[model samples]
Target chain A: MTQKPSRTQALYAWLDERLGLTTINKLVLDRKVPKVNWWYTLGSATLFLFILQVVTGIFLTVYYVPTPDHAYDSVNYIMQGVRFGWLVRGIHHWGASFMVLFVFLHMLRVFYMGAYKYPRELTWMIGVLLFVLTLGMGFTGYLLPWNQRAYWATTVGTQIAGTPPIIGPWITRILRGGEEISALTLSRFFALHIWMIPGLMALLIAVHLYLVIRIGISNPPSKDE
Target chain B: MSSHNPHDLSRRDFFKIVSSFVGSLMGLILGLPLISYFVSPALDEQGGEKWIPAGPLDNYPVGEPTLFTFTLTKQHGWEKTAQSYGVYIIRHSDTEVTVFSNVCTHLACRVRWHDDVSEFICPCHDAHFAEDGTVISGPAPRPLDKYEYKIEDGTLYLHLVEG
Candidate 1:
């Protein structure tokens, strides 16, 4: 006859007994997740878009120069000299547009489905912050080109910021780094786009996911409730 | 007295109904796309970047700025890509020329040349740049960036920057 396992082995066996692979597989394949409308997939899509951004962004960082002087030349080199440089840049550019688009749609779906209620409120709020960061990413990324379009767009965007009361001028000054958009502005935007915004977004997204899993999926509105 | 209740469905029968319903729904959703993802790329051509010729110098008038648009293919690692860029070229004299990117310095707004004012203007924020590419009166911090240009036998060649 086969001998029984030792105490430690038995403990491991008991733990596995409580949550066995077969049982986990059953949970995943049993369709225990709610079978909601197609809107339920936007969250996963948004997450996918984020992954794309990170990947493309990393490739872009390889060739992109954060400084003002070399920024334009480097981008040109990528366009003209680098092998498949235009495609990488194009994907990065268009990827940003798609990210913003999908993120907005994701938020709208969540709102319409009443996913923001009660236990999910924090998750929704974090998502809202992420949306703002997405816009920030767009704004900052636009300036990196150092082209006429980037220059003018920054002017318009910053001027709009100047319209707000009290801290408008201060904010503008901080953003521009003096009286006008210059090297300082480029550096500031570079920092925010590459580091600050991405960092904050990652942290917030982690919290958002944690809250989502901890609270479980929110149910759709019922007639009785 | 023994009685049989026909209205009650057995546990196994109920489970069969649920399983079949879920299976059919999943099949309807995932069946087509999963197969396509595996088979599509193999049937398609090997895609890569292509260099497109922009235009010649004769097409651009002297003392007047002209917008040159071109589409170029870009390769992003394992992926293929394409995008369009617009460049504003001004021929100051026969050999002296200046090329300014159409993208505005402020926020990436496309700047238009105003012949009346002899300046590049960004209507989005009223940003202005001189004909020489200096920032004039608007919120723009710097002048428009000049592209590396070459005239080979009168054919104007411009270097495009991928962003």
Candidate 2:
């Protein structure tokens, strides 16, 4: 008589049949990255920073208040009152800057390598979109503190957005949620910073990663193809 | 793929229906609280005016404006915050009192009472406000904001928004 498969083997076979888990592992995890130096890691680093930002931002939201009246005080309370709140906020604050910096550096590396040329145009375009989204996140998050610097800086920033040829005024009004910055502006910025931009970024990042994997990382510049 | 027997097909269909029902029930069990947590802030009621007692009228000396500080509790969504509010109380007479917000009109800096200069000086932009809350000099675009105040039974109450 034929022997029955072991319990572990049966379970694995069952999962593999439905999910093709092993095939996914072979295609994704076992796929080889180019044997370039440390420069290839910046994209992954930027992704890591994005995750860190999301986690810390979620923690901050527990105590943060997005309102003109209490935004500043709530930030102060987070930085001072909650346990290890300073560490979380500090990491989030610095992580945002690092994310922007790393994304720029990664783009620079890709551009310098001419990876944007030929078959990788779509990848490069998605990357550029991600860069703009990162900037949007920074701009939106800057106003959450609602202090003098945050207030005036946002005012000037929105005014600059109001300087474009035809769409300037509309952009400013949409960003500010009205003619001037008020509680509505704070609410808009908060929504964009915490959810909308991040959600779009996540989707774009997934697509960018899929494209990169499908196209493969471009080879380093060399004499031969 | 292989063809299945009718008896086996019916059994599989029953399992599929049962699994989907269980999956939907599980999703409902997990999703309701998360949805509520996300929407709680938008549904919060955080508006209304509350008159806060700054201090007694007798505490202020005549002519010389004294700063009265009071704690204003603000509620935003689920968070309750207490911010210190300060106003310059100028007692002109026994019944007449003028209260000016310490916030500078130029850039919202806290203006302090300078006894030597005899005018409120904004260290931020060097703006000056006279004892009567008018802009005396500097980049201030308007006079200091006068908060609505009322004196009742020797106690001075300021009409402030409590979240």
Candidate 3:
């Protein structure tokens, strides 16, 4: 026959019981985790894309200049001087496009599955804000090249923003730095793109995930039940 | 509950099925690309300064402006993009050359060389520039930007901006 365990082992067992690791495991394994469809993979994919963005973005930030005069040249230097810089830039550019695509798809998945109802409403709202911020990142990054296309596109974009009602002129002036796309505008957009928007995205993502965990995953509404 | 028993797989069977499905999907998504990278020929292109000859010096006659067309091929990371630019090379003399980008200072429209008037005219917004690339009239606030150039063996080589 086997002997009884020592006092130390028994004490550790009691602590584990109080912590309820077994109970948590049962909850995770038994409590339905929505075996919906492949659409659920989108959230995990978006998270993966975000991680890729952060890594590539950090690599780019090491070479990118936020200034107006040198920003374009510095990017060129990276492309010409650095090892595998072109591949890095291509990955960054393509990754950005993919990030936007995945985010939009993720939103659609949430909508179609009715995952944004009730307690997840705030999470949906945060996701929407993150979507807009992603667009902001794209627009701001487009100007960093300082080429003719970048210059003209930014000019047209800011001019369009100036068409809004009351604060149109003020907003355009603020965006362009003086009724037009200038060096100041490039500097401002650089700051916002690299720092401001990324910071907000991180905070919003954290809050969004917190809400998601708090409410847990929503199950599909059944017709027969 | 009794009727649903046949449809439900055992826990071990379910785990086996789900894990294999997920593993295969992950492999398709990630593994194929890694294998392709090793097998691909295009992945081996190096990144460095590529010198493109814009035109022969004789093509740009003295005291006349002409458009020098050249193609720029670049590899940015994994992507290969080719772009072409028509640059105005004004041969002020045999020794002095002024290179102006064909892109209009206003809205980036292509400015044309009007031989009759001896000026660069942008039809988009009526922006005008003299043979020297200074803004002669209309909406262009800045002069046409000039590119750095060098002459070797009577051929004009221009450094195309990369980014």
Candidate 4:
């Protein structure tokens, strides 16, 4: 006698009939990766750091106040009052630096391996944009603590933005929302760090992954293609 | 089949058009509110800049810049917190008062008053400011900021704006 289909199989088949999820799974899972060394893992490590940032960042926002008035005290409360808040925040902080580092290392590996050339040009371009987004995330996150260093560093950073040329003052004004850094600047940075850059990063990351899967990971440079 | 009505819409095309319209309308409905919410913080005026009571005017003596520590209750948007502020209140006379911020002009490091050395020293970079808050010998591009102050009813109040 024939047995009934398992629940998992039934649900998957029902969805797969409409979504072609099985084809997707086969496309993603059945692919062959290059026989590269462990250096190939840097991209994955960077992705892991991004996930860590997202998780820890969500935890942090539960208590963190983006306003300058309460930002420092809220951070202090997280450190002193909340259980393991320090650990979560510490990981988030260190994870930001780690993400930047890992992305840089991944790009360097890709560049040295000549992965940016040929059909992978778009991937390299996306990688560069992602790298920039990663750095933007770091720069914006640095000010969330609302400490003295953050305040002054942001001041200097904005001033640097104001040094370009005809658009320098405009750049600074747009960033700071005025001639100087104020609560608006903090809010702007908070929004950019938590939403804007991360949103763009997520979309680009999807595209990057799609391109990677489409083109396949390039082999380490050799005389033969 | 060849005698179909000209204005007749196919089911699939009708669904596609209706769904597209509904999707765009939903996106607009959701996106406008979110954009407004995101931009509202910037639009709301930061209402913390005001004159805060520092202390009694008699607490400061003549010729010596006394450090007056005060707590400012600040409200920025929905968040409210008390932040500690310090300023050196120097009384040249009964009417002349010069209040210098303890924050170093270079990098905003707290400057310490050293009576023994007769100079305000920023420990971060070993920068020194004179008793008059001049950049005596240091990397400080400018003198310590002179905070605005007002005396009312023998009470000292600082025009606290930016840190």
Candidate 5:
């Protein structure tokens, strides 16, 4: 008679049969890569920052009221009253700026190393889209605080978008919900910041990670090739 | 292979310990703050004391007590709320004034001034207090609360303490 496998081993075997968990571990966590420098870590760093932003942003929504009247005061309460709220918000605030910086740097790294060529071109394209979404998040989130600087910054930002011809004005009106900044504009930006943009970015990030794994990390570019 | 060598094996063990420590450190750095962040609202407290203006001293007629009501706007979380407070003011002179809170000392019900009975009457529980706010006949255990006041220039100011 064969001896029974241990409980954990049996569970793992059962899961492996249905979910192919071992295959996933082998493909994702144990995959081999060519020798690379610290520059390769930039992409992962950006992803880490994105996760941080999502967590802190959700915590903020606990106290954050999207209305213009309450927005500034709510943020004030979070900073002053809520314990460690300042830290959470601080991480999210700095994380946004750093994510933008890291995404740009990661792209620059890929560009310089010529990692965007060949089979990785689609991944590069998706990453570029992700970069645009990152900027979109920053733009929408900047207005949520509704403080003096944020209010005026958004005003000028929308005005800049209104600088073109007829279509430019139309875009501005759509963004602002009218010819000027109003409560509707704030709620619209809030929706996009919390839901729409992040949702799209998450979908794109899954694709980006998949592509990164499928094509595997590119070899450091040779001087000739 | 070097992978099986003792020296390489110890180096790998060192890396495992270092990575685990760093990973746990990262979790601790964020995890503790996150616990506080979620439970913060329960820990919030807002209170203060300040001298609030009760308008010009000339507004109150000397001799009898008059109900003087003032409004205070306070920051309650995200809202600015206007709380109305009242005090019975007895002006002995332009600078000499006695201020008694409109609240009954017993159950915190509002006590109205009865000119005929010459006392503050608490309608909620049939409690009464003399003109000086001493409990006359009721379940009240103490006199009406008094507030400190001062006169500067033409304006009369009263101290507001909140918790």
Candidate 6:
């Protein structure tokens, strides 16, 4: 005689019927691949760090003010006033550094393995974009505090961006919103950091993940291939 | 080979419990403080009131209501802003002085001293006030609000009540 289904089993069945959970489980989770070493873990690690950054970032925005007048003080308040705010901001801060590091290391791994060639070329291109996006995240996030370091660092950074001949000054003007890094520049940087860069990164990441899963991870190459 | 312990909990059932428990626990831990962080600003109150110096008491001529404009450094959220304010100082004599808030009692419009009308005129609703700050006419609910003042070493200090 067949036993009755348990509550958990019934609930899962109810969800699986409508959501196609079994198809997802089979395709995304249970699919088999070639045996890989520790190096394959770096990509996943970078993705994990990005998720951590996103979580902490959403929390930080609740208290963070973007204007020049309040940016530094708001960050200072996050450090001292709000409960567990330090923890949230700390993770977002260090997670950004670690995410950038992991993205680079992951790229290095892919490069060393010759996995960027063949059917995975598109994936490699997207991965490169993700790498640049990760750096962009770091660059924009660094200037948000509006402290002395942020001010001068962005000043020099935009100046450097402007050094490449005809387009240089135009690029600096676009970034700084004027001849100097003023309140408008601060607000513009704030907008880019919180919305534009990350928004694009998130879209790229979804496509990147889809490409990785669909194309399947590349096999560990031998000298012959 | 097919003979198994029927009374034992299945591994799948055990994992379901563990996953649900761990996931809910993590959500609760992170979710509660996030709510507090966002709502903290809404619930905050400014610390207290203190005396803000308007100007020297001797500077205003007797029997004339002169405008005294000053700025207060206000701490709001993470911002410290200098908010400008205007008041009218009517010095009756050396020992007695009355300070009226320039803000109208009706809709908080700035009332100006009109020499032709001989009354403080609120441009917004045309409310008028007499020399002593009593409501002369129009939609003002009451007399103009007065600032409590204390003379210290011949200086006029306005008692500022914090919100």
User: Quick one: best TM-score, which candidate?
Assistant: 5
Alpha carbon deviation, residue B30, candidate 4 (Å): 32
lDDT of 2 at B90: 90
TM-score of each: 0.52, 0.57, 0.53, 0.57, 0.68, 0.67
- Cα deviation in Å at residue A212, candidate 4? 0.6
lDDT of 4 by residue, B6-111 (tens): 6888775687899799979966754454444335445545545688787777888989979888876766433567977788889887667999999999998999
Summarize candidate 3's per-residue lDDT along B44-105 as a digit string, tens digits.
55445656686678888888888888766665433457967888888765666888889998
DockQ ranking, high to low = 5, 6, 4, 2, 3, 1
The better candidate by DockQ, 2 or 3, is 2
Model 4 spans with C-alpha error above 4 angstroms = A1-7, B1-163
TM match of model 5 to true structure: 0.68
| Top lDDT model | 5
Model 1: residue B106 alpha-carbon error in angstroms: 51
Candidate 1, residue B3: lDDT: 30
Better of 2 and 4 by lDDT: 2
- Judged by DockQ cut-offs, is candidate 1 incorrect, acceptable, medium or high? incorrect
In model 6 chain B, where is the ten-residue run with the lowest total lDDT?
Answer: B1-10
Task: Please provide, for model 2 over A3-52, each residue's C-alpha lDDT reduced to its tens digit, 9 standing for 90 to 100.
Answer: 99999999999999999999988777567767787888899999989987
Better of 4 and 6 by TM-score: 6
Tens-digit lDDT string for candidate 1 (A39-153): 7878777877787677667667776787776788778866765555676678678889988999999999889878899878889999999999999999999999999999999
Clashes of each: 28, 0, 5, 0, 0, 0
Error (Å) of candidate 2 at residue B73 is 9.9
The digit string of per-residue lDDT tens for model 1 on B17-104 reads 9989996885655444334423433444444433335466778888788888876666543334686677888987767778889889
Between candidates 2 and 6, the lDDT winner: 6
Candidate 1 lDDT at A105 equals: 95
Which regions of candidate 6 are displaced past 4 Å? B1-32, B42-75, B80-163
The regions of model 1 sitting more than 4 angstroms off are A1-31, B1-163
